[model samples]
Structures are given as C-alpha cells and as structure tokens.
Target: MQSQPHVPGFTIRLADAEGGQEQEGAPKATRGFRRRRRNRHGRGLRGELMLPNLPGFRSRSERFDDMVLDSAERLQDMWGKQLDGVLFAVDEIPPNLEQLVAEGTAAPMGSCTPGGRGEAPMVTVYRRVVEQTATGREELQDLVHDVVVEYTAEMLGVPPETLDPVYRRRYQ
Candidate 1:
C-alpha cells in the first residue's frame, strides 16, 4: 500500500473483483472533478444550502429569483426545442446551455454563462437587479416579461405589435 505525501483523503488502492467504488480499509477520496445530476425541481445534493427563511413570506428577493427562473424556463420551453429559435441573454451572454448540460454545470446562469441564443432574442431578468427594483413578485414578473418582450420585439424587427397586451401595458 502506498500513500501520497500531504494530500488529504486520496489514496491508490487495488481494485476489488466486485468493483465497488470504495476500497476496503483505504481512506475515502475527497471530492474531485465531479458532475452531479440534480433531480427535477432543482433539488439534489447540490441544493443543500441554507436558504433564508421565507416561511409564509415570499420576500421580494425570493419572488424575483423564482419568477426569473420560471420565466427563463418558460421562454426556453416555448422556443428552445427548436434550437437557436430564441436567444436568452442574462446580464451577459451565457455559454451554450446544451454544452453546460453536457459538462454538468448546475446553474449556468449564476455562473454568468448566457442561457441561449438563436431564434428570437431574449433579455434575461437579473435576480439581484430585479429584486432590487421590484416591490414584490407581481412586479418582478412584469419586469421580466417586459425585458423579454422588448428584447424579443427587437429581434423580431417589429414594433412589438404582436406582443402580449398585458406586457405592452406593463412595460411600455
């Protein structure tokens, strides 16, 4: 048995016939380059964070975050399957969402990687900025819709005559 110098929780061990990841009597390896799969609803080991208690109170920040995520997903759902049909740019352009999925980046947006680009152009609502600007969820939703619609309209090369009436009123 050989151990490397000054490295924590790393060791080389003989493989077992059963092929278990753990080596009998060997110290467990620390987390290395890994890509964990998050379950649907965005919950998984990677979700193990102590979020601020919203308990009965959906604070402006929480609402903003939820709405931004929901709207972003919906935008993609409405158009992403078509490939490059909709462009979703966050504060800045995110890397290829398809590639991020393959590479295992859980929250690519948070990582500052643009969400999508191709078809209709999209402007992502920044959670931090939206929350800062909004007084509640309803407000945040409007803001996100406004930004998206505006960006989409620009890409459409139209005067937004086709935009949802609600968004037109809320944003314009």
Candidate 2:
C-alpha cells in the first residue's frame, strides 16, 4: 500500500475495483464522476470564493491618509505646543491659487495657508502629486516627511532644516 499525505477537511480512500491503475478496457462513463455543484446557499455557476476584507488591507487613499496623519503626529511631537494652533489637511489635489496660476507656478506637493478672521493656520498636503513623484515606497515616505517638514517650517516662518534637525539626514 502507498502512503497518502494527510489533508485537512478531506478524506481519501483507495478504489479496490482497479487498485488505482486504469483497466486496459475501462468504460469511458466510469472513468470519472460528474455532479452538479450545490451548497446551502443559492447555486448556479458558483465561481471563485471572494475573500473577506482583513486587517492591514488598506486602500491606496486610505494608506496615504494614514501617512499624512502619521507625519502630522511626528511633527506635533517634535514641535510640542507650537503646532497646537495649526491644522493639517490632506487632499487629492492642491487648490487652485489665482496668484500662483497667473504667475505660472507649477503644482506643489504641499501648501501652507496663513489664517485670518478667526481662522487657524492650515497645512495642506496633495496626495496624488506626492504619490506620482515618488519612485517607490521608501521614496514616498521620505517625500511625505519632507513635504510635512517644509510646510511646518513655512507655517512657523522658519527653514525646513530648522523645523527638524534630522530632516536632511533622512534623504542622505
């Protein structure tokens, strides 16, 4: 007798009729078994099973949103109360700026808005632009951190290096 590997949820038995070898003149009808597929649920052409959504399965936009939030959190930790009044936002694209448009300035990965009339200062990061510019995941992460640092610096009227001392070291 030959050994068969154990398979979970399935049972196997040897056929004593032919002893796992084809007969020289076996009938074609007895070669294989045919049965219509059926289940407790409705049945027709029951195709491949669809997998349920699992944890860690995030959409592209959702992942980008998380990256933006994470960068903001890192900045808040670094700058402390200095970032309390600033609002961080992530959008698919940057808003059209009439002045910049008239000047023919290209689209930016991020932009900082100064507040007025009871509004708080805002930092806006453009998701599509940044994602398109990065060559890979690591590059995307670095670019995102750089954009956030740049925007925070702009909001605080300081240079990017001053915002985070280790900022330039990340790229190197």
Candidate 3:
C-alpha cells in the first residue's frame, strides 16, 4: 500500500499481481493493438510507392546499368567473337579527371582500356559525366548507348559509325 513518487502526465496505481505498479494515464497496448514501428503517423509501411513491374520502381543507377547492358548486348550480337572477353563497367567519374582539367580538356564520357598481359579489355562509362550531359531520361539512354558504342569501337580499333550506324545518324 506504499505510495509511489509522482510522475508528470501519469497517475500511479496500486501494484498488480506481478508486484509492479501501473501508470493509469499511460497508453496500454495489447499484443494485437501495438503500434506499427514504420507507420507511426497512420500512414502505411514505408516501402516502394511504385509497383516492381513499373519502370519507376528501379533506381536511376539501376536504370543506367540496364541501359549499358542493353547497349552491350546489342553490340555483342553484332560482334560476338570480338567482344568475347571485353568487360564493360560504370564509374561515377573518370580517374584522370584532374589531369584532363589541368590540361583544359573536357571530361570524357567514357574510356577504353586495351587488354595486355592476359588481362581483359575494359570499357568504362563515367556515369556522372554522361548524366550531366543529357537533359532527359530518353537523352540519357541515348547518350549511354553512344558512349558504350564509342568505347567499344575504340577497343576494336574502328570508328564509332562502323560499329553502330545509329551513331552517325545521331550527330547528323
């Protein structure tokens, strides 16, 4: 029957059978009535607003990767044996950006590295540079494809137009 200390916004109640006092004014939550952790403000769970099947469900980087893959696949079909061991990659920025800037050259959209010492030829697209150059999603996709085509052409020692007919048409 001992009285507990006063707690603001709560009324101390008699001890229950478990020998623990209750706070009468405090919210009582049952197992089934417990508040949701993510939906505290009555909104639904914080998850993807768009369905997985929707185009917007994918992130910008993921969409960019898909664009690169699509371009690579298209090129692969055209040059199967030649592109066999060539690796395609995406990087946020080019490594030699500082040097390029020091030399007063524009940042390259992509780079081509020829294989030597049993290494594979690699084509790397600078994602940030390419994204900055394009105005819209369609433009981004086209630019990504063009960058891939240009680097692939460089790796194979051919002009971009020879690698992809659309490459010449885009500039004209």
Q: Top lDDT: which candidate number?
A: 3
Residue-by-residue lDDT tens digits, candidate 1, 14-130: 222122246679897654222346555666566524354645444444444455445545444444433232334344223365686688864222221123343232344344444
lDDT per model, in order? 0.45, 0.68, 0.73
| Model 2 agreement with the true structure over 1-172: per-residue lDDT tens digits | 1121342222122121122346779765532111335543646545534333654455577677667767776776667767766666677776665566698887799878887797667777888889989999888988888898998899899988988887868666
Give the per-residue lDDT of model 3 (tens digit) for 39-130: 55776676645788887776777677778877877786666667776677777788878999999999999888888897667788888999
The best candidate in terms of TM-score: 3
Between prediction 1 and prediction 3, which has the larger TM-score? 3
CA RMSD per model (angstroms): 18.7, 23.2, 23.1
Which residue pairs collide in model 1, if any?
Answer: 84-118, 84-119, 85-119, 85-120, 93-114, 94-113, 94-114, 95-114
Worst lDDT 10-window in candidate 1: 11-20
- Worst-scoring 10-residue span by lDDT in model 3: 10-19
Please provide TM-scores, in order, for all candidate models, with all chains considered together. 0.38, 0.62, 0.67
Candidate order (lDDT): 3, 2, 1
